[model samples]
Target: MTFTLAIVGRPNVGKSTLFNRLVGKRLALVDDQPGVTRDLREGEARLGPLRFTVIDTAGLEEATDESLQGRMRKLTERAVEMADACLFLIDARAGVLPTDEVFADILRRKNAHVILAANKSEGRAAEAGLIEAWGLGLGEPLALSAEHGEGMAELAAVLTPIAEEMAERAARVAAEAPETDVSVSDEDDDEAVRKPTRARPLQVAVVGRPNAGKSTLINKLIGEERLLTGPEAGITRDSISLAFDWGDVPTRIFDTAGMRKKAKVQEKLEKLSVADGLRAVKFAEVVIVLLDAAIPFEQQDLRIADLAEREGRAVVVAVNKWDAERHKQEKLSELREAFERLLPQLRGAPLVTISAKTGKGLDRLHAAVMRAHETWNARVSTARLNRWLEGMVSAHPPPAPGGRRIRLRYMTQVKTRPPGFVVMCSHPDKLPESYSRYLINGLRDDFDMPGTPIRLHMRSQAEKNPYKDKKNWGAPSRLRKHLDKPKPKKG
Candidate 1:
């Protein structure tokens, strides 16, 4: 029963500030520079009793061509079309410029529900602009200062009736709907009883170097041009998330900006964008490192994929633009070899070949993502792990450091979701990194966990003792001390 509200305005008009206030978090990147935001970012907005989805969109620009600004304008217009209401914000200090008038007309024609507001209306200097905002012909413009948290109560008051009206309309529609009878078989009833409750959506992130088709791939997967895509290298500047259903599985997919090397990321906005993308990778369960097939596995691509592996997320390397390549088999072979050689930590990970433009090979990509997720969450039983440890230790015993054998005692899985294990062995500090890698590789191979990072830790047997650090050595309990006292009756 919730509605969606989109905050629309030119660049540097406090849209992001108001969005952060409503969401109660700094979800969007805000800066004094114009066009800091380039994607449509959605967040759950809470304003008093009214709850709705709020989309923070790119600024409205006067461009119709296929330039970057034009594409951004198109994206913002799309948001306007989808949103239930549009909050048209104008800078009060700057007053209503020609750009503001142009976009106001655009919103008037595109969206029926529009709330005009004059932002930065906290001083006498803004009085003229506040008075001028009414001429836009939408309605009475509220004086708002997003930075100072003014006029929020008025905004909430305006939104309350709209929310109530929508709710009532929805309830009336439900009441008018006819009821249908459904028959359930005994097997169906049993199946329903065995079904698990609804769970949270799976998180997936698509990351790669500039012009590697990350946005294009996501748009193809979602079956819509929801994201702004072009031949531009850095068209996206925010890690935008969209909720979608991938074949019965609820998923939240993140489309991140292209991440260049540190030296090339000199611009403040680009650096912020890269940091935001890195955050997305850390939050995701499975990460798809998209690479251009023409030049697959570049240094930056390897670094991005390695970062995902280091973050302990499931890694899926996808070579995009396969349809444009002439020799598919040869190119794919080269990609596989390069992947295995360049990123040994993510050994045996899924390397999927996809054509993001033509929408070919997405099914394989989806399968690989699902498989990697399953392997990442794989857990082995304690008994099986111990037995496997025995075989591994017997096959190649631990190296003797200082002429002393490092005895391996037991092994057990400590956690899953990237599958962590702890092995009890003598002189864990003496265990070599090569030996740890050997054990981790063995675990991966034995448990059918491929491409998922595995954490193997060693612990000494003494560390397992519960009373190792008890005070007063082996002092008796109070009751035992009283019982052991001299027998006064016998005396």
Candidate 2:
């Protein structure tokens, strides 16, 4: 179960900083300038064992209800209402002002679970402001330095009980009415999974560098001239998504502007177009990184692929304009090698060579997409996962560092929809990148999972295991220990 928390405060109170601290990443852009974050950015946050969805809202300011700032405040209020709890941040250095009081009144009227956080409280300078926070009447204020991470443990303690309560309630609800998948025939499945009738169609965004045949390919797939296409570059300005069906699958396809080198994009519209395209990529479940066959792997193309990987979205590489290439066989082989060399993170990804203009390999492209999507949604049983882990360990044993061979004892798929696996092992942080890649590639090949991105996370089990002291005993541990142990004396 997951709960939602909204971080609300006036401008430049380090809301974004606190958000980055909670999410354990700099996902929200943090700038010293006020109002840098104008929109609400959400991320999965974790503190110790507590996990929840956290929203970083835009800073509030005084304005009329019709003004932009007023609208942003309304949005923040809506977020506060939707969240199970709210983290009301105040800059302890700046001290409590009228804006903070006004927001405090608003929060009090809402009667939401508010955790007053006194940010920037690292030194004597912030002491008076921290004392002033008591006037808000919310509760005991948590003196925190979001940037320096001074009081995260205290904040986590406050949030843990609320999170546990929400989790328990969710468990009860889930227990009362368990969800079961009801398989339906293809014909019936259409109605069951139709966009308008059922859930919203999965959004898929096709993005790449300029002249990657993005518009042409989208037209080919939709079987219509929905978007303007030409040999000239920069034809599409806005990122547009169209709803269509491929066989039985209902999908929303986003045709985006040709992304160029940041320096090359000078015009205001072009900048907006690029931003819109990125928004599409962020929102989409899967993104197809279209590469022009002529220039298969450009620097920008690799950047786009890296961005998708960083964003945790499933990706498929489509080599567009394949029919136009004169040296087809050699070029395809070269492209494959380059893909392997450049974007190794997407190793074993689906790379389909298709002519968007001629529609030569449309069926193959669709099949590749469907296969990748399935792999993205793939889940493996615990028994099968352990068996695969055993095989992986046997193939290429982890190298010993400091006379201790690393042991990977257990593996489990933590989440799917771009399957993420967690492997419990000794010195998880020390696991070589090459070894991790080997495991991931093996999983892809063994499971017939192609195209979709797979995440293999390693976690240390230092104190969790009770048999750490007995290095040479215990049957269950001995079995795993033997796998890594050097071959017994040949004699």
Candidate 3:
């Protein structure tokens, strides 16, 4: 029931400035350049009592076939269609230009509810341009300085009515719907009843190469002698799931058998243990891939991370035995750089250095797990997604091979257990693997979906069948005709 407002305009019109003002945070990277924000950034916005979703779009510009601008235009159009209203921003000091006119035309054609905002209207120089904005035919201009935070009260007044109407309509629609068992009940308002039904504690499987301090780290996090501690490789045979809480958060820690090269894994029980550990990864929401601080970023460690990514699980890297190591700073930095370079998919992923024996950095490790879990459940609005998509297309337009440019129509998140998305397009098969990687990287960087695997699927328009048109699908026409023929003259 959230009313969505998209701030859209040509480059350098202070859209990001206003976004920072409304969101009340510097979430979007702001710069003086026209296209510093090459992604659609979204935040929960509040203007007085009004609460709605706000989207910041990239700077609009002209584009040629297979050019970035063209892709950006397509992205913006999708955002406009998804939004309930749009704030068409104009640089008051610069006055209305041909790009503004073109965008205004586009907004009008979309029939989206719009408010014309003349940003940077604090000084005397902006007065004339603010007056000139009235001719854009988008009603009275709301003149305000995003940098100085002027005219926010007036912006609230403008948005109040729209917000109220949207809220009321949503309530009415919700009132007509049937309720389910999971729906909150008035009688179950007490603390005991309100507590979330905790599922079977998350099954976490810690897997890495031999002598990776898997048992030591597990013992340190749980503060118990649950697993046998030894310097010998492969001390544990079977994968074990132990119930424990990490700072009030319930967790099931699985100490698994250490994996080695396939040629070295000769024992029958060892092979079974490896398969069992992998199954645990598939079931887990968050997997802590422990690495020895001395030999961090080994090929085996990369393979473990890749497996976790492929399995669509949240991952956190814990560089253990840091207390005993010399040159700790250098090693930590090296580990981080290698992570970024080798595993671009897990951008912004948490990397913690800890001493398993001393329990150092365990608090940070726990925090990282919680953060990764939240990001794994994150959902983006369709409007904001399209806006971000537009910026990406503008930055790097999709490739064309045979004079026919690829058209990415729309993207919608179909599932979120593993954060899967489906992008509807004209030619699903024609998209290159590199382009898919590019989009995935953008998603990870912009949305803060680090240390998690994201699934992107392309679907063709021709494959969809909405109506299910088929002969004799419902009631036959002959049966309807017989019924209409007066019941066979009353028999």
By the lDDT metric, which is better: model 1 or model 3? Answer: 1
State the lDDT of candidate 3 residue by residue for 1-491, as single tens digits: 57989889988889888988888876555666566544355678977777888877767887634455555556566677778889999999999998888889889889458999999998899999898998999999999899999988999998887888888999998899887656465565433332223465655678888888887788788875545556667765445566677777678777777877778888665676577677768878888898988788888888888899888888888888888889877877788889889987787788988888888888898888888877776777888888888888889988886877887878888777578888877777888999998998889889888877889998887655653785334557777655556544564
By lDDT: ranked, best first: 1, 2, 3
Using TM-score as the measure, the top candidate is 1
Please provide, for model 2 over 1-491, each residue's C-alpha lDDT reduced to its tens digit, 9 standing for 90 to 100. 88989999999999989888988876665667676555456778999888898988878888746555665677677778878999999999999999899989998877458899899999999999989999999988999999898998998899988888898999889899967866554465422332322257767899999778898898899986555566667766556666788767878888878889898989666777788789889888778999988877888999898888888787889998888889989998999899999988888888889999999888987877766666667788889999989988897899888878899999999988678999999987677899998988898889877656788899988765576686555576658767667986886
Specify the highest-lDDT model's number: 1
Candidate 2's displacement at residue 458, Å, is 1.7
lDDT of 1 by residue, 84-143 (tens): 899999999999999999999989999989999999999899999988998999999999
TM-scores of the candidates are 0.90, 0.55, 0.55
Ranked by lDDT, the better of candidates 2 and 3 is 2
- The C-alpha lDDT values of all candidates are 0.89, 0.82, 0.79
**Off by more than 4 A, model 3:** 1-197, 463-491
